[model samples]
Target: MQVVLRKLGRGSRAVVGRLVRAPRKGSVIVIEFSDGMHEYVTTPVKRVLRLAGREVFYIETVNSRYRLEVRGREVALDGAVGG
Candidate 1:
């Protein structure tokens, strides 16, 4: 499949990375981009292994912080950033 890249940072719409797999508490997801930049995001379930992958983009507002899930076209985020 063809992949697209974009700028990502602290904002409403940030296409950070693609989901490597299911994330649990303390788990990490290796988000890769077409530009060859990558980041290791922790998962709640367990540790994560970094890897290369595709990307995404959109505008989102979450209710909470500790809970973040992506089911199809929807990205679910719960809890607060620092509360």
Candidate 2:
């Protein structure tokens, strides 16, 4: 699935890519960046929050927070876990 990942902090930029691994509790979230380099959020995921009736996701990790937006209609975020 195609996704845009942005770290929630000062001077953060969004990274567009394909989702190589889905987010699960205590697991790493992986994305194959548009530049062809794989980006990994190595900290075990703490939480995932989904906005009601939206495809956007907020993820909290051990050391940082992130905003992940699912792009395109070809993919459905059925595996996402939300709080």
Candidate 3:
């Protein structure tokens, strides 16, 4: 498996990490970060798709007006503030 890291946001230096597991289709991708915060991302076979000939899936989470793009392709997860 291979892991990649990317940085996002400001004022706290948010860190991002990603892992590609074996079995390809039904592999669980675990994501973690600093500040004792972490999220578990499970990759189901249904989410897998051949994008430009490469397998890919997406996972995201939003909390307290902070948008988090956890895994897979590059996309922003928007969060709402003060509903």
Candidate 4:
């Protein structure tokens, strides 16, 4: 799924890419950039919060917080509705 990832802090910019790995507790989140390079959240994920009935997500990792918006298609991550 296509997604836009933004770190929640000052000076942060949105990073658009394809979702390679969905955020899960105890795992790293990964995104594949358009340039074919992959961006990985080196810190282990602490939690994943999804808005009810929406494709938006809030991910809290060891050292950073992120907002992820899934675009184009519905993604059913583990623990989400219909997953």
| Clash pairs, model 4 backbone | none
RMSD of each: 11.3, 1.9, 11.4, 3.0
Best by TM-score: 4
Give the range where candidate 1 is weakest over 10 consecutive residues by summed lDDT: 54-63
Instruction: Evaluate candidate 4 by giving its C-alpha RMSD to the native, one decimal.
Output: 3.0
Q: Rate the local accuracy (lDDT) of all candidates.
A: 0.32, 0.80, 0.33, 0.78
Q: What's the CA error at residue 50 for candidate 1, in Å?
A: 24
Top candidate by lDDT = 2
1-83: candidate 2 lDDT, tens digit per residue: 88898999899988888877777767888888777766755487889888789888899988889998989545566676855
Which runs in model 4 stand beyond 4 Å of their true positions? 40-42, 78-83
lDDT for predicted candidate 1 compared with the true structure = 0.32
Q: In candidate 4, what are the lDDT values of residues 1-83, reduced to their tens digit?
A: 88898999999988888887667788777888888866744487887888887888888889999998988555657563221
The TM-score measured for candidate 3 stands at: 0.29
Candidate achieving higher TM-score, 2 or 4: 4
lDDT of 3 by residue, 1-83 (tens): 22232222455443365443321333344554433366545433222222233332232223211223334544322211111
Name model 3 segments beyond 4 Å from true: 1-15, 20-23, 34-37, 53-83
**Backbone N/Cα/C clashes per model:** 18, 0, 0, 0
TM-score of each: 0.30, 0.82, 0.29, 0.83
Residue lDDT tens for model 1, 18-46: 55444433444344444656653432333
